[model samples]
Target: MTAISDRPQMLPEQFEEFARHLGRTVEGIRLEFINGKLGIKPVPDGDHGRIIQWLNRICIQARPELYVHDQGLKIQGYRGGFARPDGTLADADAFVGRGDWATTEDVLMVAAVTSFDSETDRRDRVEKPRAYAEASIPVYLLIDRDSAEVVVHSQPDGVRYESVRILPFGKAVHLPEPVGISLDTEPLKNWVR
Candidate 1:
C-alpha cells in the first residue's frame, strides 16, 4: 500500500491564519474551517445557483423578517467551523457590517444545494449540519443532487439534530413556525446533471 496521507492537521490558531490567507488570495471561492481542518470547495455552478435562488425566494415569502444570504455564515464556537451555505436565513438584524459571515446566534436557518463534487457532498450532508448545530443554529436544509432529495434537520444538540425529515425531489418541504411558507421544490427537476 502507499504511504499514509501526509496532510498536516491544522491547529485552531493555524486555521485562523489560513482564513486570513484565503481572504488575501482567493476572493470569491470561500474555504471551510471544519472540525479543525481547512477544506477547499469548488465554486458553485449554474444548477447550484438555481437551487439557492429557489430557497431564498421561499424563505422571504415565509418570513419577511428574515434575510436570505447566499453564503457567508460563520459559527462562533471553540471548534471553529466556518460555513458559507448556498443560502442562509437570518434575522434581519443579524447583518451589521461588511463581514462575510453573520453571528450564529441570530441565524434562523442555513441551506446548501449539493454540487456534483463528492467532497462537497460530505460537507453539505454531514460536517456542515453538525457544525451548524454545535453553534446552536436552529435549522439545516440540504438539497442533495446526488439523491435528488431534500433533508430538513432541526432540534440541534450541538453535535447533531434530533429531528430529520427527508423528501424526494418535486415535493414541497414545510419549514417550522418562523418560516410558515413551504418550499416549492418543482424547480429541483431542472437541476440537470
Candidate 2:
C-alpha cells in the first residue's frame, strides 16, 4: 500500500519571516502582513478594479461620515504590521498624513477584492480575517471575483472572526455594527463579465 503523506506543515511564524524577507526584495507588487508572515497578491484585474470603483461610488452616494480608501490605504495590525485592503471604510479622522497614512482607532471596516491564486485565497479567506479580527477592526469583507461572491465577517473573537456570511452576486449584504452599510452586489455582476 502506498503511504500517505504525513509531513508537518510550516508554522505561521516561519511563513511570516519568509514573507517579510521576500517583501523586502520584491518591488511593485502589493504585500500584506498576515499573522507575522508576508502575503504577496497580484495587482488586481479589471474586474476587481471595477468592483472597487463601484463600492467606492456607493459609499460616496451614501455619505455615511466614514473614510473610504479605494486602493491606496494601508491597515496595520498590532504584531503583523500593515495590509492594504482593496476598500476600507473607517471614521474620517482615522487616516492621517500625506505620504504615509497611518491607521488609527477610528478605523472600522477593511475589505479585499480577491482575484488571485490559491495561496492568496487562503490568506484572504483565513489569515487576513484572523489578522483583522485581532486588530479589532469591526468588519472584514472578502469579495471573490471567481465565484462572484462576497463574504462578510464580523464580531472578532480573539484572533479569529465570527458571524461569517457569504452573499452571492445579485444579493445585498449588510455590514453589522461599527459599519452600518448595506452593500449591494447586484450591480457588481455587470463588472465581472
Candidate 3:
C-alpha cells in the first residue's frame, strides 16, 4: 500500500489553477499546499482579524516601504508548495505583476496567525516554519492565539531557523535583521480568545 508521504504532490501550476478556480467558486475558505499535503484555512474570526490589523499598524508605522497582509507565496524549495501567509512583509511593490503565486525572492518575513482549527498546529506551527526556512525567508512570525504567545523565527540556514524566540503576550518581541522591528505585544493580550 502507498503511504500518504509517498503520494504524488500536485504540480505548482496545476495547484495554482485549482486554487484560482476554488477562489472563484468558494466563499469562506482558503487553500494551501505545504510539505506535499493540501491544507484548508477557514475564514478567520474577529479576534484573528484584529491581531492582523494591529500588526499591520505597527509594521506600517515602522517601515512604510514594507507591507504585511494576505499574500500568496511559493515555498518549500521547489516542492510545489504554495502558502497564503496572513501577513507577508516585503517591499511595497514586491508582488506587483507577479501574479497569484509570487516568488519568495523579495519576502522579508511571513507571519501566520493561528486560527481555531484542527490544522493550525501542523500548518502554522510545523510545516510553515520549515517551508519558509527552506525558501530562506529571513523571518517567520507566529502569533499563536491558542497559547497567547508570539514566536519569532529567524536566521534560516536553508534547512531551519537558527534562532527562535518565544514571548508571552504583554512582553516585547524583537524580530531580527531584514525585519528590524520591535513589537510591544501587550495589546496582543486583548486580541486573543
Q: Which candidate tops lDDT?
A: 3
Off by over 4 Å in 2: 1-27, 70-79, 98-101
Judging by TM-score against the true structure, name the best candidate: 3
> Where's the lowest-lDDT run of ten residues in candidate 3?
4-13
Cα lDDT of all candidates, in order?
A: 0.75, 0.69, 0.88
Provide the global lDDT of candidate 3 against the true structure: 0.88
Per-residue lDDT tens digits for candidate 3, residues 1-193, read: 9787867477777788899999898999988888667788888899888888998889989999988857889885746689999989998889998887888999999988899889889888888898899999999999998999999999999989999999999999988898899999999988876
Look at candidate 2 and tell me the lDDT of residue 38: 54
Off by over 4 Å in 1: 1-8
Candidate order (lDDT) = 3, 1, 2
Q: How accurate is candidate 2 locally (lDDT)?
A: 0.69
TM-score of each: 0.86, 0.76, 0.95
Model 2 quality (TM-score)? 0.76
* Per-candidate total of colliding backbone pairs: 0, 1, 0
lDDT of 1 by residue, 3-67 (tens): 33433367655765677777788865667777666777878888888777777777777677777
Alpha-carbon error at 52 in model 3, in Å? 0.9
* lDDT tens digits by residue: candidate 2, 34-139: 4445556777778778887777777767765665774333344544356678777865555655333345356678888776677866777776787778778788
